[model samples]
Target: MKIPQKPNDLNEIFKNNIIKLMKLFEEKEVKEFIGEANNKYIHWDKLRRLKMPGNEKPDMIWALIKLSRMVTYRNIKFNKYVFNYSSLSEFQKRLHLLDKGMGGKILSNNGSVIISSQERERYILSSLMEEAIASSQLEGAVTTRKLAKEILRSNKKPKTYSEQMIMNGYITMQEIIKIKEKKLTKGLILKLHKSITKDTLKDKKYEDTFRDNNEVVVGDSIELDKIYHQPPNYKEIPKLIDELCEFVNNDEKEFIHPIIKGIILHFLIGYIHPFEDGNGRTARTLFYWYALTRGYWLFEFMAISRIILRSKVKYGMAYLYTETDDNDITYFIDYNLKCIEKAMRDMNSYIDRKQKEQTELLNIVKKIKNINLRQAELLKEAVKESEKPITISEVINTFGVAYDTARNDLLQLSKSGYLEKTKIQKKYLFRINKDKIITELK
Candidate 1:
């Protein structure tokens, strides 16, 4: 993407006409515009396209909006730059909703747990695969979602670099969950980076180490000549990272919400660009790590990257807006909040759809004498993909159960004529018995 237009300086616009601008802000139309603009956190590029209220110029209106934002801005000093964010009404609404949805039990409108304990593990596994694939894809790992899921589910060694990236992401995500309770430190960051970039980088030496040179710049992969961001100097990385660790580990005097703090951590890794490669992947992983550690347990089942992949342009523009508009990170914060909200919504929709399917499958399978919920779920998958064979190992991974338990579930279904079991080589493969299942349903 091309560089965004830098916003005009607020001081320059309001210097001679501070009194006139303050009076103009009281106008009804201008008040309405400011309210609407603040709700969406509109940046100058988009704001300039909108027609001004009455006779007001866009730049003048922008100055008014900036002035309104100044009162609510909370500042953080990182190195020499002063980065700030405003928690607008919309932001608070989102944070409240996200806290309600993710911090406690996720419930539907009717007040029922969206995911039960029995099925929570399955949902988390599926979401982790999705997050891993999308995160890798964002960093230019080119592999089909189907192939990536297959590689993860079957525990097959990745034969290609793209596949390796996906596997590394999956591994790193699991590792983050295990170490969520640990304090943030430079060594821990290096360890996570090593796990995320293993076998995916060109040089092994750069795997867990900070870059020593300043050649790295984030640019548009499509438009190779257009540079989107030039990170801080390589010499500043150690100091920057030390500050970041302190920021993450210690609670601020003036309360910064955990979600917002997590998003800031996400942005800092990208801004610092401490590593030669895999910085984007590392940044995203840190976001997940921070959220989960803060007791937002429901985040384990929501893939924010999947939602982000759909609006990749907005994701890039959020970073550009923050950089171009005087180090105001509200733009990036707003973008991520929306992504998190959408991911939660998407996850709920997915769970609802799956619940409906399971209800239907259970209704049909309840006619059978001794089939269990696990058997019903397995049968549902088999019915959906009748041509694809199922393996015990896949079931073990999907259900987070042991090999014996998975094997027994399939074997019982096979013995009851719901599935046809055959030995392929030394491993057992189960196929849906289409005719028998149709007769039973009928």
Candidate 2:
């Protein structure tokens, strides 16, 4: 991506057009335009293209927007820099919706659970797989989503470096869930990085350790000459990380909403670039850890990375905008909040689709007597792909059921003529008995 043009200095614009700017601010249309611009948090690059009202220049409008934001910006000290962000109306509206949606209040009108206990596990597993694949893809992992899901579900050893990256991401996400209760520490961060970069980095020593040399610069992968960011000096990593741990662990000084805090943690890791590889994956995992630990239970079902992967350029620009524009992290925070909102919407759509599928599966069960819900689901899947053989292990992994339970479900379907079972070596493969199912339904 090309580097964004740095915003013109706000002070210079104010100094040059003091009387004109003051008079424009009093105009109703100018005030309305400022409100609209601030709500979207329009950066100068895009702001400059907008048609100015009453023949005023776009930079004057940008100056006014910056002036308004400065009043509400809150400061955070990180190492030698002081970063700030403002909670605009847009942010507040989204946060309110997210709090209502993700704070364990996901229920139907009847006050019963929207996602039942049985469905919760399946959704969580699907979400983890999605996040793993997309996060790896964001880092340039080359694999189809279908192939990646099959690799994860079959628990097979990855055959390529790209697959290895995806597998590492999956394992790291699971590990984050397991250790969500622990406080953020440099050690914990290293552990997560090790899991995320296992067998994927060129050097083994860099897997769990910070880089000792300032050789790493985030540059455009295509152009190779355009540098996007240069992280802090390598020698300062330990102290910077120490300060980061304290910032995340202790919340007494000020009140940052849990979601915002999580996004900030995500941005800091990317900014710090403490490791030689897998910094992006580690940063995203830490965001999930912070959110899950802070009681956003619904995040386990939301794949924010999947949404981010759809707009990879914007994701990169959010960081660039924050860094170039005087460390005003509102750009990063705003981008993440929008991604989270989309993820939440996607999660709800997924639940609705799954619920519809379950209803259809129930209808199938009514037609096929003596079959359980699990068997009915298998039949539904088999109907969709009759030629593909289903294995006991696949069933177990998909449903999170015991080995015996998966075996019994497949065997019962075979005996009932809903599936055709064949033994190859010591393993049994089940396929849809298309003729028998057609005859029975008739």
Candidate 3:
């Protein structure tokens, strides 16, 4: 008899991951990790409160979740590079493995390998993740080319034709820029989207290629790759994506931390495998965007994927441990939290050092007599931007007052002999004198 496909019956990955994570909330390690590190590295609190440039703070949460959906997808795509591939040459030869399980495509499991289907599901997820960049940024007019441009802007490289051919679900980075530069019409998005779909249709022609003559998947049917059970229907995936997108956007219920929610979103999305091609990437990116949208930047600053990528076994094991024993998503959440906590710890230390220095500067400012608020701040900026002193024009620009207002702020401290003025033509620049903060007031 054939083995059953899929590992479990749970429909939501987030629900499972979150359920597992709740136990650690009261632990000493968890407490030390969040409170002591406050507003430093894992600044989920800060991000939650942040004001997005063009939108309200709360509304930005959804946008961030959307953004994370894509970024998570990208991180996972690059991650597989470390495994599966023995060498770059081997990958270049066999990358066609990308299309097998895309769009609900599945193959029968055989011995050792899902040989016909190896890596196809993964590749499809990567393409879906790539689509997210455009989905979040451009909205209705998104095309494959537009999506490619979005990736190029973020990753800082142009896409080649081969790259576009491989990312059959979305536009190549090269084509995205082509549209932006006015070389391609807005209508081109329709053509490109259709073209990618058409290209993917050809994968059916090669189904046998991924399959052996035996009509079953080959290679290691290790615990990781075998259909934990039958992969779900294609239509069912979008529902999970929509539900998760909503969960991350929730504004009510403050006691449950937003950081927890972000991690939960990642777990649920990964488990759902909503997109045939880009589940892992989508999970990570949405995890990020979820945090970002929640104004959780201090925590988001850590780039969770970089942490997860640092050790694939731990990352995978975290999933396996939580996936089996129960429907608990706790392990996944805790692992992500720890990864974020570590990043925040690094950031917090840096912040604490800077803040300590800021305090010292403030004390020095206190010693200067007749030092107005502007000059005190100027001193602070001078120290922070120690590479150079603040220019009079910069002070004026920062304050949005008169040029003379800038000069006078500088002049008061200068007369106190607490500041030194440098001149170029008609303009003056100011620098703090040594011990000036101490000398000016007395």
TM-score for predicted model 1 compared with the true structure: 0.94
Q: What shift in Å separates residue 116 of candidate 1 from its native position after superposition?
A: 3.0
User: Residue 60 in candidate 1 has what lDDT?
Assistant: 92
- The true-versus-predicted C-alpha distance at residue 277 of model 1, in Å, is 1.4
RMSD for each model, in Å, please?
A: 1.9, 1.9, 22.7
Give the per-residue lDDT digits (tens) of candidate 3, residues 1-442.
Answer: 1221223322343345444334444445544443333212222223445453334333233223322222322121111111010112222222222212122322222212221243333223333434433332222223354445334322323354333333442333223323332221213322333343333333444311211122222113455464432333444544444554444454563333556665666676556544333345445545554554444423322334445555555666565544442334544655666676554444445445544654565676567545655577677767555556566665543444467877788888778766687888986767777665544445
- How close to the true structure is residue 359 of candidate 1, measured as C-alpha lDDT? 74
lDDT values, one for every candidate: 0.89, 0.88, 0.43
Winning model by lDDT: 1
Q: How accurate is candidate 1 locally (lDDT)?
A: 0.89
| Clash pairs detected, candidate 2 | none
TM-score of each: 0.94, 0.95, 0.35
The sequence of per-residue lDDT tens digits that candidate 1 reaches over residues 1-442 is: 7677887877888897788898998899899989999888998988999989986788899999988898889999889868989987888899998877755666654566656788778888899999999999998889889889978987788998999999999989988999999989999999999999999888999999999998999987778888988989999999999999999989856678899999999999999999999998999999999999898888898899988899988899999999988889999999999999999889888877776776786797687668877788888789899999899998987787789999999999899889999997999999999998888877
Stretches of candidate 1 off by over 4 Å are: none
Q: Put down candidate 2 lDDT per residue, 2-84, tens digits, no spaces.
A: 77788888888888999988888899999999898888888788888889888788888888888888999999997797899
Off by over 4 Å in 2: 15-20, 103-114
